[model samples]
Target: MSKLEHAELVDGVREELITYLQNGTVNKQAVARTLDITELGIDEIDRLKRIHFCLSSDVVDFIETLQGRLRRIKTANQRDREITRGEVRGGIDWQATTRVRYTESAGDRTRFACKTPYTEYDIGENLVLKKLLWLVHSTVQEDISDINYDWRREAWPTERIAMFDRIYARNVHLNRIRDGEDIRVTRRMLNTARTARQSLYTDAYRLYDRYRRLLAGKYEDEDVSQLLSNTLVIPERLPRLFELFCIFQLLRCLSSRGLRLQPIESGAKQLAILESDQYTVDIYHDQNGGLSFHVPLSELEGIEADYIDRYQNVQRRHGELVDAFLGNDTQPSLFSGRPDLVLEVYESRAREVLTAVVLGEIKYSDNQQTFTRGLEELLKYIEFAQYEEYLSDLDIDIQGLIISDGVETNRDSPLDGEVTHISASDLISVGYPESWIPTQIR
Candidate 1:
């Protein structure tokens, strides 16, 4: 390995990750999970040891802006009045009945009825209420309340945690909105609040817009994983960091090929789709059960026979892998197989791979031993995929690749099968993912 290969402070790693985020739309949840793929052990030190209140700057802006505006929120009111014999308000309605019936009393006395048009500052004020509720009940707010010992908070020092507690409680309480009031957060209501034309509300809307932009993965030059992790989650280990570097490098490669990120419908895997006129590529990292394509051992008879046939065809010193020897109880037969990284490509409209399956392993070192080990792993994964159950149901072809720093590799492969291995060092010398996987468009 080169002196700089896994050096203490790896240059360009964080910068590379940040550049990728700035360039493409990614699965944020998946990104979050990947950047924090560390677990605690009884003997090993954990990453999340230094835990303090952490929120993005945008989150701070959303909380503080709302906190400042809540004090002077302008109320938009819509109200009406009616005739009453009580006190005079909003002027009396002249057309309303002026006659009043006296209550049953010892002395017969007559009272006057005054129809009044009193304005209740409800509708317009409720607009602000609707806007407030809309923002307060959003995922943004849920994210905060999720972490708060109680409620509202920010990194701001003017007023500390107690101040946040008061503000958050007050905001949720929403004293501006009365109990039993009808408050609906409709698009029209939001538009009304947004276009309220008041400086206070307009400022509130500005903060709202900023917050939304931040939520949409628009952090200028910030490494989101680091920003959120606070020196924790972003792996300090060289190998792990290299793994993330590789994944992002893959994302950039796919992004260049018109990759569109699909929102994760369920779990923490980053799933993306790359489509072309002829086919669609489904890119998944950690898949269902951590294997994008897997299969059982029983489905491998034809594939095993293929290997045996290849061994027979090729001029080799080894004898044939006869069925009796392969399946004898003297040794246990292999059962199932899966790979490390995956990019599943098929037809544009089809759900299965009609062409071929390309298997690859990512290695961070340039040393021969690491390279050879990675190749062996890749060969096994690829070779086994040819024999797996779920995949065996469909017609399949298999190829292999090993992405490494550089290797004096002898190109060990299956009987007659040759796997392509490339150096990822091209990322620095040539371009991104600079090495090519077998199935890549290029």
Candidate 2:
């Protein structure tokens, strides 16, 4: 093929990628399945490890809620501790106290062996929680060099990793649980835990059972398989993967700010909902949500009109772009070709009113033409699509941002202040403003 034909072919491929990504198919799990952990860099491996841990939502909830559930797991009256002072600390075993005295036949009268029964904690079933905590803590605290996939580490960012350190610290509930022969767990012991008759212990027992099962490498969940199975790797051949990676990086950064991943319904195509009590960011992969494609939009209330609108209805209309695309007979989503990602940011506290929107078009190409084409689409989106800040306070504004996987070219737009592009790698490390989010919550 000639250069013109080659360029056209390449452009055709880029267009198809948007459709594939937008069709509810390119989610975290799907993207994860395409990952080859061995081929990734150390930081990227750590990044995957973090996302992998989260892919198992059950596991995330289990870890976060486990300690709180350990209530019914009170100290048991365990009776087999050895006392060093000949005096019986709990009960005297004359045999134990005197046998050692007699066996040595040395004049060591100060040392006495006694049978001590203590109630501080038990090593039978009660110790299972400690053992579980120890297992997770040790795995998380391992040096990156020691990562051999024996267990996947939850390498949270610095502060959060320190937070995990505190939660996993043995001293938080009792002495640090050290691994040893004494910490051994048997099948009988696990069975005893699972069969606990008390309702109060139900959650605790269930969590412990999962902990034991997970540690044993019996991952019955497909999410866990995606995380641990070496063969279920992301090959380089997967298209538009960098787009997903860029989004994951954004999610990770938002996560560092107390935003959490909300569970999507089974078979749901939503990429994710990064939410906090104050805000909700619903991210869609390569679908028309804001303007053309499908958006899993939540019905919201409390839409007070632009408070100023009560005085004067100053209206704004997206002009030229509207003239180009809008028609009375047209039906869209109703379907238009999907944008790479449609992020609907909402003020969840205000009846989940939309506050901001991020209409994104990802181009996994260094080709100037490809980059320019994607950038033009985004600029056009800004022209026709206007998401208002409906709080009646902040002025509605429109801006654009590009997040990429290290493709460098001039992205300056002559029509506006900026259609600034950012490297995906930097997004992982830095913070961004709410204004950079073009569409606002209604």
Candidate 3:
């Protein structure tokens, strides 16, 4: 298959796998049917199932750890508040008589209108516990929803069912707090709830342990043993994880270069600002960098009318790179293409001047074909930026780079001259140099 075709196949498989893992009902049969329809061989399907189990197991482990930590969190001292009601009484609030009403017929009767207050223990730890419980509940529910396997049959071990039930009950009890169920009225009841947290963790641990033991035991078929082994491999999540990993790595590099990195607080975009004493860099992801341009209609007199028309048509159709040339508007065109990452450099001191803009693409796959396709795409973006006169008019040089797992590139490749292909690790280790910022643009 061609590289593009293979990438599409990988993406399709990933979506199916994600859907299967998130399904609340563990419907393995459904997933098997889907895989069969895709024409994946039995072996391939089995491998994918094993990977699903491994990732799901990791999630279970995470919840187990979180619950354990919740159990260990030191309980806070309980505070008591005086409250008064009919029949139940505590210390009197002499200053507040609104709750007291005297009846003429039942004058001076203690039962009729007694000013009293009772101390109710308020355990602050319950709030923490409730929040932690909610986290556990939500995490489990999400994981369960992803599961495409049905566990109604005896095929699923009894222990798993029991463990899930215990956790679900805990979630329900905590959820009831919003519905007037008090979790901290009495000391004994509060203590019991605290202990239940530990018990839940223990039950979950044992359930996972049982699975591990079962997998460890020798099976009649070697293939079955291999397939059921505890080892888990998930390539589907790698690309996104790699992207995040790069973001943080770049953050660290920029920090090392005496720049303070702050995430932009705008809801419309996910971007970060790297500020130094004299300069700033705006990191944009999957957005147009919030730029627009205005050009004088007369500028089209020099350029071909058809070419200008085509450019304007393309700009309107894509809403990406806007018209950067020939206009009083200082902003560049909204870039038509959304790269994985974009860095816009500026001089922060005195006058805020845009120095350069860098576009980047990330490819996590080690496959040569995938790397080539990504490189081509990166080159195309660079070409658009370079050939577009409007982009040049912005007075900022445009550069592009591809971050990928190590891949060999041809020396004569067009990308070799304009775009840099750097391993993700190396890029993180060595900070991106200022030289990469085109001096000519400044």
lDDT of 3 by residue, 48-82 (tens): 44333433544355444543354344334333344
Give the runs in model 2 whose Cα sits over 4 Å from its true position.
1-229, 236-238, 293-335, 349-352, 386-399, 409-418, 428-442
Tens digits of per-residue lDDT for model 2 on 1-442? 0122223323333332233333322353444343444444333333454444433445445566555565545565556756464455666666666676677746456556655666655544556656655545554465332444422344334444466566665434445333422577667756766666653334445555654443343445443343444222333433355665556655655566676776555455567776777777777775545444321112112445576333222211233345568742322221124567777766773534565556677665555676678788776665545343222234434456665445564543334544667654355455433334443332
TM-score of 1: 0.55
In angstroms, give how far residue 360 of model 3 lies from its true place: 1.2
For candidate 2, which ten residues in a row score worst on lDDT? Answer: 293-302
Please name the candidate that would achieve the greatest TM-score relative to the true structure. Answer: 1
Which tens-of-lDDT digit does each residue in 96-147 have in candidate 1? 3332333322222332334444334344444554344355434333333334
Count of steric clashes across candidates, in order: 10, 15, 28
